[model samples]
Target: MKMNNVIFIMGVSGCGKTTIGKLLSEELSLPFFDADDFHSVANIKKMSEGKPLNDTDREGWLKIINKLAIDQSLKKGCVIACSALKEHYRFILSTKLETNAKWVYLSGSFEDVYNQISERKNHFMPSELLQSQFEILEVPANAIEVSITNSPLEIIKIIKKQYMKSEFGLFGLGVMGKSLTRNLANNGFKISMFNRHVAGVSENVAVNFKNEHDELSNTLAFDNIEAFVNSLQTPRKIMLMVNAGKVTDYVIEDLLPYLSEGDTLIDGGNSNYKKTKERSAYLKSKNIYFIGTGVSGGEEGALKGPSIMPGGSKETYESIAPFLNAIAAKDKNNLPCCTYIGPDGSGHFVKMVHNGIEYAEMQLLAEVYVILKELGNIPDEIADILESWKASASSYLLEITIDILRKKEGDDWLVNKIMDKAGNKGTGNWTTIATAELGVSSSLIASALFARYTSFYKEERVQLNKLYDKQTQTPKITVAEVFETYQFARIVNHYQGIKLIAEASKAFEWHINLSEMARIWTNGCIIRSTFMEELVEILKETDNILTNSVIVDQTKSLKPSANKVIAQCALAELPIVCMSESVNFFNGLTTADSSANIIQAQRDYFGSHTYQRLDDESGAFYHTEWINE
Candidate 1:
């Protein structure tokens, strides 16, 4: 009842704005201001003489009312009666009070409004000019619409009910879902949460979450599908945080029947981009809105703020932008780390590439840990050394690696006690396959994925270790060289991942902005880093990172360090799969005259495949027998 919202009752003249505004004003215990009182004497005189005010005439009056609304919004808030007939007029009145303003549209037929105006006593807006007001009325898409046929008291009740409906609905109660819901509620959004109740497992999950977070008074939880759907306002926005793949499909089918036209559904899981595109089409066929948003930063980020990538209809995106932006992480410049990706599936595709880069980055760091360990550096010493690089090479991966190294179980290093095998959740595999399909090389990401697959052979590795003894010698590499190699390898890894995304964006006609991707990743995602911050600026000039002069100069300086690290690791019988592949990929990519000519000749000799000659600047192909009998 004590809501801090600047409520505006808008409609054509004689639509009961003043009548309901006064009743609601008393109900909410807020000051009521009529727009007529703020109008200039000349404006009232013109209107009284049966002439309507033009846009220019009303501009200053709207500004005066907006100033009053702004001041009241900062205080307890107020109710205002205004004929905000045009969309721009509403926009002018609500400027600087976006989040705190709520609109109630008093809709009525011509006959109803005409009758009310005929009975009016001393209003300056004459009955003859009522038709002019209706002609210029631009109905709002983001307001609570109520019929003026209802009595003023009944109208007040409807307004209150619609105004108090939950602003957003989140339909999953898992770790990430719960965290995000709490984050929304913390940001002053009334949210409804729905988690289906199973017989034994997850029974009353939604209810229990609400009970546990008793401090979040703006949240509601439900186990019934219809009840949950009905709890939201019109054109409801619901985000699903369930598992990707079939489980996501199942949840969509379950909610489809309850969703109305114009309602928006967001898949906030790690769903495949292809699936997201299909879902977008499927939902569009039914007049429902769908957005495939890629949310990163894991559980902690969900509780605080994660980077958000939403792609679907840009129109529908605007309807939910306020809520998404409120809960998204901020970059160095204090901009929200959420943006509209090109269209359906682009957001998920970006997230998939993010995970691919994550795989390579983690592998690169792990290789650094092994090389440092082989160089007789203890866990604590390595942690300190890596922590010292935060000024220039800070990253979420490096920060966590430092924590992981220094974490001890009593007197022993805990990381040593953990299993060597790494697990993947299919995104890296998808990235590798996509690169091959797109004819783009992402060797660093592939090597990282292969390293995880190879680590799964625990028994085979044990037997091989015994059968073929590695006469391993300690590498004569300094910690500084290893750090430099790590930096160079990370640059190559990011380049490869982004190149894959750029290729896909071209192939799919997504028209994605590569620089914006870097900007968003600069803060909340796992791959966020000081390097990503640099990339935000670097990519603005050129989409190809290799073509950028600064990166090229840095690569020139760091290539020798990478080569030295790889050479010593190879001689010492150490495996640096991702780092070594990064250098190899770079070399292959930069080479203009590759040995593929020999490959072409071999293919032609065996399969009679024709070859193009280097001298053939003209468009021509040639074939000749090397051995003439």
Candidate 2:
């Protein structure tokens, strides 16, 4: 009963494609589709007139077929008889179908196909046009090649015999890996799950997972790396969900021996972007495709749907887009939260910035919580207030914070019992480093990361508090003022984060579509929100968020409250690192005339560096001395 979700009976005209496809569909109890039925009237006319259609002509037709295949892939498998002649045409037809699509090429001599077409009574494809198809035919090497001379029944039998391999392969059966595997299986993609057998650690990890999920009849599990690789269909798509660094490399090295030239390897970890670039180049030399994809949302998101950011060769991305999209979270418009970011490492870089923004957002929430606590509101009341802000400022982070604040263990607040120290898993650090390296302004992200580092010195902070006799008067800040401050800081956080991404795109020639990135972040990501939905529109208007009228008006209205909160927090001896930096970054960015002239003068006086003169029409550079040595 093992079968591809989409069986494409492909060949030039008059190759028994329809005959074989219909027979196969009946045998598999699947629906059948003819590519000709979906063609536009203009296309039919062009072909009927014996004129060959160009790539541009077939582009829309191919996309329509691809969409049909993707839709059918989520339901019962379908059999499609298509003249998927050129390699690029086949690629387009299989866009979202990925490994779930299998090709059955009807092979025959040109003369034989021509004779069969000449004998046909009624068909839109004329025998005269058959020669053009043959001329454009880029035969697929990975198809189940059956001679057109064979009976339809015999060809179906051969196809059934060869289509037993799983649609996709997943290596690493840890938390994220296992969740993704189940997600793929649930989406009707036959998947092979693999995990190295480590005694006492992960013995029979994949095998046990398969046994536990008996309903996942489409899956095969293996502790043997060779067996796992062999279980996948050709142009094998294997995603590595292991740890980012040495573990990912070691697993890749082990799998390399078994992988072929056309196979693709995906890293679904928070690996450093530079490392991703290195691995991508290395794999390209080996003739293997490497994709560095960022899978956001935690365990629940993985099992349900996560926002997927995949970057690699555009061609390579097409081979795996369907499988990723099928398991990606849907936005309000029901579009998958996945897109082809760009070439090598860009996905990871976007994800790194995403995590950095996540840090700032989380710290913003924490600061709000502390301010509320200082103003004499308990955890429960604070949670309710935050819950009320959902209509305007709702986000995944905010939702989770509300739950965490409301959580109690035996009448004692669990959050209160927890330590004040915060922990980060390197992505936030990587974000700050990338921002600095790219010379982008990311003070909010940097301040958030530094706050975490400072929190690590819990003992030092406690000791210093006593030495300084740390005490604070309650800040005269209303909930409305605090909420406004939160809104303003969040707007600035997103602006800075997007700016960093925009700068990196310019510096590295990534050419990332900020609008698409915003769309993907509208769901399944930690920073997803109503604000992201608005941002999706704003980014489409301009790259600089501050310039948008919506952002400008909102910031203008919220600026007074943000200023008051910062001033009062400082006077009350309370720390608001991320919020303070957010306001400061905004102030610095908006300043038309800056005091940097003094710094430039100081540098010129000491180091003899040149400075550009604002008064000079020709933009002349000059250096001056101040004090006589």
Candidate 3:
């Protein structure tokens, strides 16, 4: 590997390029070359006469250096000290090299370089020519930029840390893939990108990404899967950000031939956890590692940083933790909002629940907006109220909601002009199904999903609006009461969602840490909020949060406000389905007694289904022989 690690230390004269190059050559046990030695007699004499060397004079000098770089790179790798000041010069020097020549730019102020030049004991380059070199220098964005502020040893350490033999590979150059690729490159990780081309598209997304980010030295694009796989270092790490299901499976199968044992394949999409589990097991049988990673936050978050949840073998996660954590969102404490969730589908499972809670929260917010608007508050006034709510219940969604409320197109509010229909991409439904499978109550999330479905009946709703003639006054509800109601609903929504997750943890044997999950959701993800931070602390105190005395006390105090808000919305003939269902769920779960006993008797009498009596042993079933009156 060292034989293929060709390095170029580049800067203006007096920036210590030659010194650093020699040191690097010795450190890495490679031969060193100074571009000055490759200069022609005429070029050397011209510099000896204290004259500035122009592009014409430097052309031959660059060719010689290029050949040396190519030749040495093919052999036992070499370090070259070159003042490759211009981008064109660097290009010429690297054009023929099969592998990228790692260019390290030693950056410093003109004053600093001049001072060093003035103090030089003996050199062909004159101090007077230093100014011209500085003037003509074109900084390479593709090169690693190292400041001269640190000692030579420190600078060498920086360069060594920045340069890695093999880079990460990404498949699928879609929006999420492109954004994540850029994010990784920005963090100084070399990334190899490949996209399966489809006809009719004028430009290839992978090609466009390469062209747009040409200045990023660490990013490489490939059209062939074979070459892309081969370009990655041994024990290769590749992430698939393609469509879920069969497409993901197809990509894995295609790449499997090229991948060796211990290499990892990460699925960073919204794949079904069951599919993820199957893939992980399959890959394990082949001696390759599979990670089912859940990446939250959308395109913008991908470009910046997102909360990352990686689930697979603990050893596999450890191998990729450095890259994952380096590119993950940081909280207020500067900790990455990422962690190893568990084995198999735990990461994706957590993400599914995150989306589920996102659905409920959005529905709750929409209900609040509708209630306030029905109460005759203008968009601007509602925006103001939402802005104030930030202090009490701060979240990324809330901030965006406020901005959305304030937006206007000409004389009309954009929200008012938009269609009433809502859309989802299946994660919400997935959560609903998972909860049902676990026999967990997730009425708030289920109600939210149904709300979107009901919204799709646009024609029916319009006709119903025209036919219905019932008139009613808007129920009086204070803004404070409405706010209190929203807060309460949010708690209930999160509570039910968390309960579902807890049940899943037990059923799946994931042993998920609820507090840690809450902490990870406090940033980057769509459902991130100040509320989650508080919830994390609360969960640490007790595992059964629903039955925790502190939460129970809070719920008791907030119940009246929720009831009032629900009553007013109902009186005003507005639907608060999620909130109403959440209240119902809470009531049903907390109630000590109910009418289910009579229903149980009916079932026993009709079908001979056994029912447990209150006075009987808990596990014992009894059949009653009763006569119907």
The TM-score leader among the candidates is 1
Lowest summed lDDT across 10 adjacent residues in model 2 is found at 1-10
Tens-digit lDDT string for candidate 1 (226-328): 9999999877899999999999999989998998898889999998998999999999999999999999999999988999999887777877787888899
Q: How many clashes does each candidate structure show, in the order listed? A: 0, 0, 0
lDDT values, one for every candidate: 0.90, 0.90, 0.85
lDDT of 2 by residue, 7-87 (tens): 899999898888888898888999999998998999999888878889998999999999998888888879999999988
Off by over 4 Å in 1: 1-3, 11-16, 39-64, 82-98, 106-141, 147-154, 601-613, 617-629
Q: List the residue pairs that clash in candidate 1.
A: none
lDDT of 3 at 531: 86
**Candidate 2: which stretches are off by over 4 Å?**
1-6, 14-80, 86-102, 105-131, 134-158, 627-629
Tens digit of lDDT per residue, candidate 3, span 1-629? 23255688999999999888888788788899988888898988999999998899999889888888878877988999999998789878976562346778999999988887888877899889998998989876445678877788998887776565346889998899988898887765778889986677724667777888744455777777888888775567899999988999999999999998878999999988889999999999999999999999899888788999888887788767767876788887878889989988999998998999999999988998988888898889999999999997999889989989999999988999989999988889999999989999888999999999999999998888889975546768888888888888888888888888888888888988889888888888999999888888888876567677867887788889888888877888889898888778888887899888889999999999989877866779998789856
Models 1 onward score TM values of 0.91, 0.88, 0.75
RMSD list, candidates in order: 3.2, 4.2, 15.5
- In terms of TM-score, how similar is model 1 to the real structure? 0.91
Clashes of 2: 0
Q: Candidate 2's C-alpha lDDT? A: 0.90
Question: Which one wins by TM-score: 1 or 2?
Answer: 1
